[model samples]
Target: MSNPSIIFIPGSYVLLPVYQPLFDAVSEAGYEIKGIHPPTVGLSSRQGRESPAPSMYDDAAVIAQAAEKLADQGKDVILMGHSYAGIPMSQSTKGLGKEERRAQGKPGGIVQLAFISCLVPAIGSSAASLLGRFPNEKRPLVSIDEDGWMLMEDPEATARMICQELPPKEGEAIVTGFAKHSAQSFGNQLTHAGYKDIPVSYLLCEEDLAGPPDFQREMIAMIAEASGRKVDVTSIKAGHCPNLTAKDETIEWVLNVVRKAEESRPTV
Candidate 1:
């Protein structure tokens, strides 16, 4: 069998660079790793001034395209989504699983999904709704720009909410890198629940203030109930950004998931 490839989808307002450490670690472990920087997060200056900003659907399409490219090369793909990215990650892998691709005469497709301190919404659920807001209301954590983009509100708020456990300087650096998020993404609903058919895992960040442990537990339970299957879960004592605050533990959990996926593959 070909070596598996892992594609990482970062959280809202965060670019691929934010996960460099985790990427390096994964690469060093002898697995191929790719990071998808969604255009919906407004990282590109070209999208900054565009009207009718991009949505989560656009983000999912980008992710799906990347996965398809790897899958075409006969690489078993594993998707790792962090924070708000869980939604897109799940959506992108829908109907693109190994089994589904094999039926379509393709070489490979997504084999597993890993959600790290992230939203695990049901089909047709929007991020804003999952975060405890009614339709057309402001999202819980961040402030919105006049042009329909979302901002981190402030560095202090980001520190308190997402990276409380990190060293002060490190947390500050993360905040400084925050970019505007497309407000439209929050209202876009997921069309498919990939976890229902895919092997799934969730890493609960116990010390996460932004995505509280209790809520993460609730999402896990909900997913299991909806999918009618168990979701492998592991807990780590870290802030929302476990890849940064608890790098070693996060990588260990990721590797464990990969090993399990490999074990489950059929022998020739």
Candidate 2:
């Protein structure tokens, strides 16, 4: 459990840079942090093309490769997923944690999974399924083009929903950096449920308009029921983007979970 690598997966339409503060804080606290920018979120002109847009499975494959590399170096990992990125985060870490690798006489496997106001779906479930259940008016914040790519319809509305606590300029920066997300990923079912095997923590953003508190609780309950263990949950009074709105608190909560995971690790 010494110096585990902290890998972050950001939600749809945003890039890894948005979590720079959280990354910096974790780094300053003496932990390595890696951000996985999902290909599903077309962050570059190359990715924005109609032809070669990536899906959730593709995103998970990329993350899984990263985790494997870290595991090969004998470093345990903490995989954190934000928003829609949770799907790939959970799916990617499956059978790649220290315990799982060690069981196979290999090194490096994920030791913890952290969901930050992210979707927690079961095996065979898709993030879109959960999102689709929301009222029609509340859903469809993003418009999906004919090419099966998704984009924010109104940046102002998006900012108010997820970044309401941030300053106008900072919120605008997030909006400006918005990318086109692949619609295929939304409907892709997860092959594995990492939370069922790996230790998990859920950071519930109470003021999240995208993922309401009650819905988060329901997801947590679902996870607990499926896993046959209670999922550790920490609450923050912020919008969807807590890493931006409540940076310091988010860091503390993350570190707290890291410490708990370290303590619970089996001593060799």
Candidate 3:
């Protein structure tokens, strides 16, 4: 059997920094790892500012193209999504077949999905809905600037949104790199979640302020119920980005999921 390959998709308004620790850990565990940079990061407005161009649908299109390429390689592929990227990753694994489409066989092509402190919404929910509304009915995703950067409309507010249990370093990083998100991306609803039926797992960071451990649990329970399979829930005592605080455990959890998926693949 060939070595398994893992694709790491980072969350909203940032590059691969949030995933670096986890990816490094996974690489050390003897699996091939790749980072998928959806233009959603730099293609938007400054952090907590306005968006560049709007459209989560456009983001999904880009992600799906990348996913198809990875899926075509015929390696046991594991798609792991962090934060907002989960929405697109969910859309990427749709309509794949296993073993030439055996009679009523389980869907294949994508082996598994793991969401790291993300909002993996049900088929009909939008990102805006996930974040809820701000005062005066303003949407959080609409605060991008002209150059498509996202920042906290109010730095203090952004701080509060992500500051519950983060360390001083993480809070500083969030202030520096916090970019704006496209309202269109947040508003872009998924037509169907391709990863909905795939075996899935959720990693909850118990001390995370961005997504909060409590919220993470709720999202996991919802996705698990909707997918009609119990999610393999793993809890870590880190902030929103486990790759940073709990790198070793994050990598171990990812490897476990990939190994399980590879083992579950139908043998020829």
User: Candidate 3, 158: how far from true, in Å?
Assistant: 3.6
The C-alpha TM-scores of every prediction are 0.92, 0.93, 0.82
RMSD of each: 2.7, 2.0, 3.9
Candidate 1 Cα errors over 4 Å, as ranges: 44-51, 133-141
Best by TM-score: 2
Clashes of each: 0, 4, 32
- Could you tell me how far off, in angstroms, the CA of residue 79 lies in candidate 1 after the best superposition? 0.9
Worst 10 residues of 3 by lDDT: 133-142
Please identify which of the two predictions, 1 or 3, would achieve the higher lDDT against the true structure.
1
Give the runs in model 3 whose Cα sits over 4 Å from its true position. Answer: 43-54, 97-108, 133-142, 146-149, 153-170
Q: State how far residue 1 of model 1 sits from its true place (Å).
A: 1.4
Name the candidate, 1 or 3, with the larger TM-score value: 1
What is the alpha-carbon lDDT for the whole of candidate 1? Answer: 0.83
